[model samples]
Target: MIDTIIFDLGAVLIDWNPHYMYRTLFTDEQEMKDFLATVCTPDWNEEQDAGRPLREGTDILVAQYPQHEAYIRAFYDRWEEMLGEPFHDTVELFRRLKISGKYKIYALTNWSAETFPVALARYDFLSWFDGIVVSGVEKMRKPAPEFYQILLDRYHVDPQNALFIDDNYRNIVAAEKAGIKSIHFTSAGQLEKELEGLKLL
Candidate 1:
């Protein structure tokens, strides 16, 4: 039986658009793409999520591209704009699950401390979760095995009794390898079917 549900924040609960922030700040697409490729890559985000200081990351970016130092800072400052609204129906589904009292819901997200509060302020539904595990605060991230182990240990949940949902295939694969049941979320409809298959509802 699935007694707990772990959810990824980005692309699952809230939409993220790298292009949106780029378009908003830079008039030149090539420059924007180049900067993203070199400086704002996933590795940088991961480092930031793993408790690396934002100012240090910003300093590194500034040192790399001296000409766009201010622009880069502004990009980080307004990064929250890149995250769009929450997925429709998912919030309602979460509310339903919360009221059902059949499963414990927790958020396990690869999010930076710098950006998480912005997300929390933007989405009130975030407050509904029983527990929240953010990579920045935890100094760990998904697919690392330790991240899932921390959640399992903290909640006293058996890996077999937990279902982790994430938009990233790698995260789901990692959770599965850790002996936790997982759902690779593509859409609300698909997630609903997966839950039904598990007889969770």
Candidate 2:
């Protein structure tokens, strides 16, 4: 009886990876790993994802790790290089759902507010989403119960009739905690099968 579908943007649909860009910046593979782990860690990036200004985040990181200033600046300066575009098979399913006119399709993503516009401009299919709740825009990222509530409240989405798909297990857990059905997305084919099993495809 699900009438709404929520999709996580990164990993699930968009193949966004810092490694894609970092591969060019550092010649040493171990150094790249060390830099990502210690200098520009995921925790640091998540703060930006939670509505911190990109410029401010970049400057702070630069000051904290002065040795990595160039690399830190490159993270946002050449940000688009990280985008690998949308997964075609999953997008095909989304388009099918759209064409059927039977459900509300939405995007719930934890992306930086400043850099997200680049994606909107590059991906035409983004326009097809009935609604989008960006963590950066809301100043709250996923895995937080309040963030999910915002999506439910703002969109007036019926929790019982919604199906959430996210590549991150933490986000999936949060969605389930909010009383929405969820899928820990892996492949496009797997998602199609899940939708079929739900009789939503």
Best by lDDT: 2
Q: For candidate 2, write residues 66-123 as lDDT tens digits.
A: 9889999999898899899689888899899999999999999999988899999998
Q: Count the clashes in each prediction.
A: 0, 0
Against the reference, the lDDT scores of all candidates come to: 0.85, 0.92
lDDT at position 64, candidate 2:
92
Candidate 2 TM-score to native: 0.97
Pairs that clash in candidate 1: none
Worst 10 residues of 1 by lDDT: 88-97
Q: Once superposed on the true structure, which residue ranges of model 1 sit more than 4 Å away at CA? A: 28-31
lDDT of 2: 0.92
Instruction: Using TM-score, give the best candidate's number.
Output: 2
- Residue-level error in angstroms, candidate 2, position 51: 0.7
